[model samples]
Target: METKKCTSRQSHFAKKRYILYDVNPLEGFNLRRDVYVRIATFLKRLNAEDKQYQWILVLPPWGPLYHWQSNHIGSQIQLKWGMFFDIESLRKYIPVMEMHEFISDYPVNNGKTTIDIIYQLRNDKNMYETGIFKEKNMIVSCSNGPVSYKIIHDQQYTGFFWGYSNISSYDLQCLIFHGTILNLKNNFNPNLYRSIMFDHMEIPLHYTYGSTEYWEARRSMRYNSILYNIAYNFTSKYINLMEHMDLICDLKNNQGKNLSQKPPQTPVTHGFDLTVNGIAFIVNFLDHFTETYLVIIDAHTKWPKVLNLKKIMEAYGLLEKFKCLLARYDSPIHVVTDGGPQLSSASSLSIEASSSCV
Candidate 1:
């Protein structure tokens, strides 16, 4: 745990990744001591290994804070909510790798920026600088995306509850801020890093997962003002269209109608026929930027499972997923499809399942 020894041991042999993980914020929700103990034990394993690539968890500065009076203390319930690493053990990592160490080394006047180690190193090279912090390229947020919940959490404006809860992404921003604060002993320009962390609180829109339209400029001024309004509109319209059996039964005094009181008397058909289909969408991966996701949906229960595919609806890949579904769930007598080239009846999966495609 000596700072100098840890730093000396930090030399990279291959491309090293600093996987900053968000600690599970809700560890003690059930008021169990065993959960907290397990979380601490689990986190301790991060520094237990030495590898070319590694994961480092940045925990928030968690400590006790009292409201009204010091005597009237907050409960343990308030303590477990923040997602940062446990504050107590965090100091050991100060010399290990600090947040300020990852601060974008770009010039001060340009604007706030995330750590782009290679670009800034090249920028230094432009100035005729050499051997300037020579090390492997460092990429922040290796485990997750740059768009974090804390980055979009708005804190300045006040409401009735008015920041009392701090239930928003406050912990995430604090986690990043502490990353810089912990490494103050070696920060090039602490003030610049502070400003960079400030950007997380200013914007309040979640980053679009699949699209890279705005990653170039972290946030657009126009979208920051009212994009949430559009998001609110879309979120409000999603409702359960299925008939509420409980509500109907309550109104009818249980006279009838558990499920569509009018049953199909003629035949036992589609209910026994469970069909699966998928739509491809873009998703970001750990190593690659994005890949096609084949999201399979059960027509009856509306349950969904996703499979990552290399190409758009590749037949062999589709067959693999179809076989997986058949093994997991009841075998449909016949699988219906729009006869797309990928999910066609001629595919080996239909033959395997003895399923005739429509």
Candidate 2:
């Protein structure tokens, strides 16, 4: 009974640790989205372990991505994650909160929140040069190369934390990491830190590609309804425009000459009863085993003509039926076929004698 009381007490004291992550500054929006799946999978594994502390994933904010170059949408810097993703959908797979929510929940110092630790991940150079890859995770000094985070005078390291000035980190460790995301589990020290951020988090690949966890994480990343509505509106407008226009216009230059180009006119030159301007022909054999029928349709008027054939249909019989159709109406300018054997075996002379087979 005393041991059970101790275990219950420990369970009651379990803390909630937040995992924050960011991709490289050079990475585009789509790649960053993939990184989310990696981190979510890692968090799911961490929680499945039933550790003493509950793990929560802090969603990184969207920002001035190079691919988001649309000038019409105004500045895209420091956009909230909720602007593009459904927060509730994401929570169904893993516990996730936006940057603002994290800030609100975190204790601030002098109007700023200092993350407990930040890991600047770098790819192992030897792996690329030697053409041999192996799992590696080591704490080392920041390389002389262009590092994104800088140590300020206050001993606090600062960088473009999604353009948030109030976020800083005191314990910044440079890690040479090359492996799947599960390998990063070694860095978690729940007793020492509550919030940990990983810069260049995209360096690590998925823990288990195409696994059940991966698919669940992928499905959880639902786009916001606003984006869906925008896409629906744009698609509907474009389809409606295509009904009357055939050419694509430069959206930037709405008044350009390309937008003024006329749509191609239809080739029909005669009224419904005057001439057969176009023809489409097919053969029906499904209903009867002893008889074959040739079907010819006027492309313009949709008028159909069915001619019955004897036990067998030959090229000569097909030509004679076509000639009869021409004799009833003006010779069609174009003739089409389903490429049935009767049509395929017909001599070019016989078909051309009626009309051009197109």
Candidate 3:
């Protein structure tokens, strides 16, 4: 009887500890968000690309002053920041709050202090930057550029929703969106949730985490390592990547709410039609390399002609290819393309050929 009583008591205490850990295991440590903000702010002082992340400068074991001066300042940091890393590495690099006691073993109060670096992240500036993406030569710069611009709106909601010291605005928003999705999954009202998410949150149209557009965008971002390197959300970005857009966001138009409209009728033709499709450069086979393919098929005859081009079928390239085909084969009675810039511009080419040749 005594053994059973003791075991029950131990089990009760164990459950309480688990609950405490879930709430927060290290809450007693008194870690201030000010420390994180200061560290990130100081990194930005470097005046380099996407200052949120900068290479930690270290002393060269064998280098003398003259050798260091011979190389470009950024060369030391080159290929060091890397495409993938975490916040822990950053914390070890620098701390916003300095705990080390001043050396000289005496409180002289003469030389520079770490206090000069503690900027308190004033004016609601984000302690960490994330999400914004860029491309080409300025990709990293472009991704980090929007961090400051988003601070005002994103931080306001993040603080209002869940103002834990360690949580940054970008993360808080991800959680909010994540929870909203879970709530909907559990049968929460779609209309009300969308009202808050769209009108209130102002997340751009078709950018919702579960939306088709969001997944398409994410797939594009992931396939290109350059852009993926700058993305901040990896886990939460995939929270609902497979789910379809929630019906709530498919806001219906009420402009014709009380009016009746007739269904449109179309006339079917039995004429020859040309389906011209150009596969744009889906992915560069190698860095700085890409190709475009053009396909022309007869809708009725079922005959297909494929052209493999060495160049990305740009507007001019499409015009040249389409002209060559028309010059050789029967003039396509009508042409249709999936909005390829090259193929669309062929409209003029078609008119010219009609007037001069066919």
Better of 1 and 3 by lDDT: 1
Global fold similarity of model 2 (TM-score): 0.62
Worst lDDT run of 10 residues, candidate 1, spans 244-253
- Which whole-number lDDT from 0 to 100 does residue 190 have in model 1? 22
Enumerate clash totals for all models, in the order shown.
6, 0, 0
lDDT of 1: 0.27
Clashing pairs in 3: none
> Which candidate leads the pack in TM-score?
2
Task: Record all residue pairs in model 2 with backbone atoms less than 3 Å apart, i.e. clashing.
Answer: none
Task: Score residue 158 of candidate 1 by CA lDDT.
Answer: 17
Where model 3 places Cα greater than 4 Å from the true spot, the runs are: 1-290, 330-332, 340-358
Q: What lDDT is reached at residue 199 by model 3?
A: 11
Q: Least accurate stretch of 10 residues (summed lDDT) in model 3?
A: 15-24
Model 1 alpha-carbon drift over 4 Å, by segment: 1-18, 21-51, 56-324, 328-358
How do all models score by TM-score?
0.20, 0.62, 0.17
* Of 1 and 2, the candidate ranking higher by lDDT: 2
lDDT of 2 at 230: 61
